[model samples]
Target: MGIRVGTRDDAEAIAEVHIASWRVGYAHVLPESVLYADDFEPRRRAIWSEWRFAPTQRVAVSVDDTDRVVGFAAYGPERERARGTTGRGELYAFYFHPDVWGNGAAAGLIDHVGERLRAEGFDEAVLWVLDDNPRARAFYERHGWHPTGIAADFDVHCELSVPEVEYHSPLTVEGRP
Candidate 1:
């Protein structure tokens, strides 16, 4: 697997990963009607098409041997409302195609994103995950991200919402031995 910066041209592939991952990952936690909606792909594609990465924002994609995007991570300066100090970064979105779940692509993306965040001078970072998603929570725990106990209800759609918890990680300073 390889990791690199994502571009506008990758919007479709990124959307594919987003939908596939959500379909499998959130099957139990989220409503099937919303996940299987026909407009889901188009909506995601539209979002990716218009996404503008801020100067401090970084988007990374993990590709297979064929150079096809298999996973992606979008992060940037921590947004307001998250419980964190200054100089913090936020992992806005992360997803991988279900087919590549156990192939270490996810690990590579997390490490790459952490390095990018540290290089940007962020001392720490936070990400929101579904409170009931054991697989994702465990993955973050194994990756050194601990829950901050900050919980919120994430609106998945009109009249559909779920609980989420924030996970925090302190990015090692660059040049540290």
Candidate 2:
């Protein structure tokens, strides 16, 4: 597999992955219609708009030898309320499609963002995942992230809301070497 920066033409596939990930990742927490709604066109358009121009963000996608993007992630600098980082730079997001769940795609994602953040002089990163998302929480913990016991409100589908658990890592990736 190979990874590269995302572009305009990738919006459709990106939308597909985003939908698929939600269907799987949030199976229990969220309503199925939230992801599998009849308003596909609108959702696609919205994702295209946001994912295309999100600030301080770069969406890196992984593709097969045939150049099919299987999974993607977006990471960049942001404020870290969880890391106690008032001025310290932070990476905001990282995600991979379920199809590539254990295939080292997630690791490649962090490596990609880490390179960019490091080059930008940022030595740490922060991410907030739902507390009940054990699969993801365990993944972060394994990657050397530490919980800050910081819970914040998360808005999903504009109608549903939940609490998020915060995690942090320093330049050395903390516990993992």
Which of the numbered candidates is closest to the native, going by highest lDDT? 1
Instruction: Please write out the lDDT profile of model 2 over residues 109-137, one tens digit for every residue.
Output: 66666666666667776778887798888
**What CA RMSD would you report for each candidate?**
2.2, 2.9
Across residues 126-150, which tens digit of lDDT does each residue of candidate 1 receive? 8999999999889889888999889
TM-score of 2: 0.84
What TM-score does structure 1 among the candidates reach?
0.93
Sliding window of 10 residues with minimal summed lDDT for model 1 = 168-177
The collision pairs in model 2 are none
lDDT of each: 0.85, 0.71
Angstrom error of the Cα, residue 13, model 1: value is 0.3
Using all chains and alpha carbons, the TM-scores for the candidates as numbered come to 0.93, 0.84
The lDDT, on a scale of 0 to 1, for candidate 2 is 0.71
